[model samples]
Target chain A: MDRSGTMLFADLLGRAKTRIMADWSAELERANARVPGRVSTQELVAQGREVLELLQSAASSGDSDPTSAAYSRLRDLLAEMSRARAFQGFSPTETATFVFSLKKPVFDAFRTEPDLSPDAMSAGLWTATTLIDGLGLFTMEVFQKSREEVIIRQQREISELSTPVVKLWDGVLALPLIGTLDSERTQVVMENLLQSIVDHTAEIAIIDITGVPTVDTLVAQHLLKTVAAARLMGADCIISGIRPQIAQTMVHLGVELNVVSKATLADALALALQRIGRRVVSASPAPAVRASA
Target chain B: MDRIPILKMGHALLVTIQVDMHDQLAMALEEDLTARIAATGARGVLIDISSLEIVDSFIGRMLDSIAAVSRLLDARTVVVGMRPAVAITLVELGLSMPGVNTALNVERGLALIGVSVSGDGEHDAGTEV
Candidate 1:
């Protein structure tokens, strides 16, 4: 608490930076954090140095609490590092190791301070332990959040990709749904199909659900909602690809798809063509060979 | 008090809702549509909502009511050109407007109502209720 003690702590921290950097990098390598190719050793060392410099200044200022305003710069650095690691596909352990590996080098620095009493040495080591542990945990928390954001964004992209509305004919469109019909996905499916319907001036839309894995009550409801939305846009909807199992499930659930449905995409397309006064006729069979028999 | 104009095309009445329909305006449109349907003995009513970006449950109910009224008068109603966003919102709101018929555009809607786009009587007979 005295001026000399504070000055000595600052001097020790200044001397500890290089040792910590070297030891931390070696510790990370020992921990195999560099194996993932997510971050290069040089990049990791640079980041570690910046964090250590900030930590030394804050710690010497008597700001031991990681969550305090004094540690804001250190927190930002750790958060940025964690987010980068998360997006780069590093494991949470590896991300946290970036912070935890600093503990050994810091404690070594405290041990080299021979002028300090035994009690002061332990206290300094404890402060470093607490700060390092807090920083490590903060990195994990940020990693989790960033990973979650990545997952949610990927889910959105997948949902958008799964619902593709293809124009089967001038006035007909086909939407082949290939996944579970959750409420969010259903919203995407309906919006995409309906937008295509309006754009194509499609008279009929065939929603093929063969790629859909199951037909629960909720999924059926979402399908019906899509159908209704399509119909509202002045497009008749034909739900195709209702496998026998799905049909059975629908029957057992007593879910009536009030709209017309076909068992196959080809059947739905054929019917759609027929409704629009068009039909695909097979080309005349190859001229029969009179002497074949 | 803006009134939605109802244009007569052959034996069908076309109402293009280009403005945002409030409660009163929706009710008035419903009344006017029913009265016109009864007086003109219109065989089909086509309501175009392509320009409408939002259709809450209230407007959704109005569409249903209009369809029901037209059906009772022996006239078919086809709602056409509903925007995708509006349709999605309506479905999310759990108002599907089951009683109303929908078409992709006015041309197809007229065909559904038994009137040809070229004003021909070829498909008109099939549309009679």
Candidate 2:
């Protein structure tokens, strides 16, 4: 708080910079923060040195509050580091350890200050603890946000991948849904299926829900809407992959698909082929008769 | 008043909606289609809406009305080329157009009505009734 105390703290940090960085990096390594192979020892040490230098300068600026404008540079550095670590797949503990690992080195430096009395040493250590703790928690918060963003993006991609419309036959299309049909995914399914129908000029679309785990009223409604959209596009829809459980659920829920549904994709495909005047007949065993003769 | 044109293709009447239809234009189209169906004795009516980006509840109701009127006139109605967004929006708007037959395109619409006629030849025999 006083001018001499601030000068002593700055001199202690300046003299202990190399030792603090070495101890901090060793601590991070012990914590397995660098085990993910995302960051190298050299890069980690460089980052630690930059952060320590910034912390030393900010603390010596006569403002001990880490949240003040004096610590803006330090805060920005920590935020950037946490965001990068988050995108690099660092766990929350590993991300926060970047700041938490510095506490011991800083406390050791404060202890080694011979000229400081017990009260001054305690005050300096407390200031370092508060600043490091605040920054560590900040890193965790930024890391969580980044992780959430990654998860949401991956979920969107997975939903898009799940709904694929395949051209099963010349006049038939198949959409094998593989997950729970939420409203968003259903929209994707409908758009992909309808677009394929238009592209192939298919007359019948077989929507196979066998891979779908369950069918609630809402899912059933989405299916019906998809069917209606396909029919509106001039293609009658035949729902395939209606497992017995789903059938019972549909009946129990009184959710009428109002479209023809088959027990299996093969059956649906066969019926679709039949409607298009095509049959998959096996050749008779005339070769066996010739061999017997 | 801009009137939607209804072209007669053999026994079927074709109405391709290329403009963003207002309530008045949609109503006029419905009246004109009914009059054309009566005058031409058409057995099938095809409404192509591929170019129509938006179909509000009013236009949706007009479509239902047109289908119902056509059915009363003993004609099969097929609404074809509905955009995917429009279909989704229509369903979300709670206008499924239950009575209207839908196809993917005009060719399919014609095929649908044609199949219905051939399948129900006896029904076509009493067109006047």
Candidate 3:
């Protein structure tokens, strides 16, 4: 009953491969229709044939445990399939269904086996249930892991894309900060701004936070730290783009940004130009601008 | 027993720390800078630390003391050429060193000390005390 159960199931699987595949394909079509991703009939048939072949060999090894070395190749193939389907935006249920759908067809083949003993029949059924269930859970694990990897990669890319230092003028750089300020983001911002100061020999850096949603004590502290770091590198930071609401919130929180700050980027730039001993004067005394219709 | 070379450029004194600093070296530098300020009656002191790659809490405190002592001696001290990594580290360590003035390089440092960087070696107006 122990070893012969899996071997009997393996033998029946090989003998009824064509009939089981036909039933599995029909089950897969019903499951696939509910899923968002597209798996063409030809590709589905090909994958089914491959999985059936691998499963037959693995079951013949008389190891009911899917994690056993005898099932290593089968595990690899399922892991690969789940990873691919995960990237294709398939849900966890859909991926696991690909393995679970094989259960019914394989069990139906057990019923069709002629003159099968009651003991062997029950043992094979138990083996089939455990083996297929283990494989289904495995696909789910692989799917979830791949999804987590994609999320982490996207988080890193977003942080990298958020910080950009622009050279507004010679010796003047501007960092337009959008979104919230976390410690990790502040670290990236400070690094990029400081490097820009050294690279461009910039004397003044304008931190425009107009796009920032709110100003809490933590965010204000991060701003002050960045300012101090810039000052240590011989560049002064001017924080601008203070919305009326953020200004009120800051005042209420008593967040003292000792460094110079202005209401707008233009005002900060003007102050910066003044500090560096530069003046922008109009060349013509005529109208500053003439709108032509 | 190596001493950091201090070159007198007109009314401003230039001290370029080309080697890693130990406790004794830092102490010697602080003493020598004060003595030099008293002896030379220099108006500006520019310490170029661009070559310095590492700093500790002791060094941070030493810089603050140098700036304080030099200020008492009626000399404006501007520490210049701090690397980005050093600045970030200092900030993370909570050592802002507010007493010291910083500049990007020697040229900017000289300008901050009110010394015109002329090739003809012209001594201009000194830093305001």
Ranking of all candidate structures by their DockQ, best first:
1, 3, 2
> Which CAPRI tier for candidate 3?
medium
Each model's TM-score, in the order given? 0.85, 0.88, 0.92
What does candidate 3's lDDT look like per residue over B1-129, in tens digits?
888878898889999998998989999999999999999998889999999999988898999899999999888889899999999999999999989989899999988777432322232211111
DockQ of every candidate structure: 0.58, 0.45, 0.50
TM-scores (chain A) of the candidates:
0.89, 0.85, 0.92
* TM-score for chain A, prediction 2: 0.85
What are the lDDT figures for the candidates, one per model? 0.82, 0.83, 0.88
lDDT by residue (A127-244, candidate 1, tens digit) is 6677778888999999999999999999888998999999999888999999898998888888888888868888789999999999988998899999878877777789899999
Instruction: State the weakest 10-residue window (summed lDDT) of model 1 chain B.
Output: B120-129
* Number of colliding residue pairs in model 3: 0
RMSD (CA, Å), each prediction = 3.9, 4.1, 4.1
Give the Å error, residue A158, model 1.
1.1
lDDT of 2 by residue, B36-104 (tens): 999999999999999999889999899999999999999999999988788878877878887898877
Give the alpha carbon lDDT tens digit for every residue of A134-219 in model 2.
87887788789888989999999999889988988887898999989999998899889878887898888889998999998899
Best first by lDDT, ranked: 3, 2, 1
Q: Is candidate 2 or candidate 3 better by TM-score?
A: 3
Worst 10 residues of 3 chain B by lDDT: B120-129
Compare the candidates by TM-score and give the number of the best one. Answer: 3
- Cα miss at A151, model 2 (Å)? 0.8
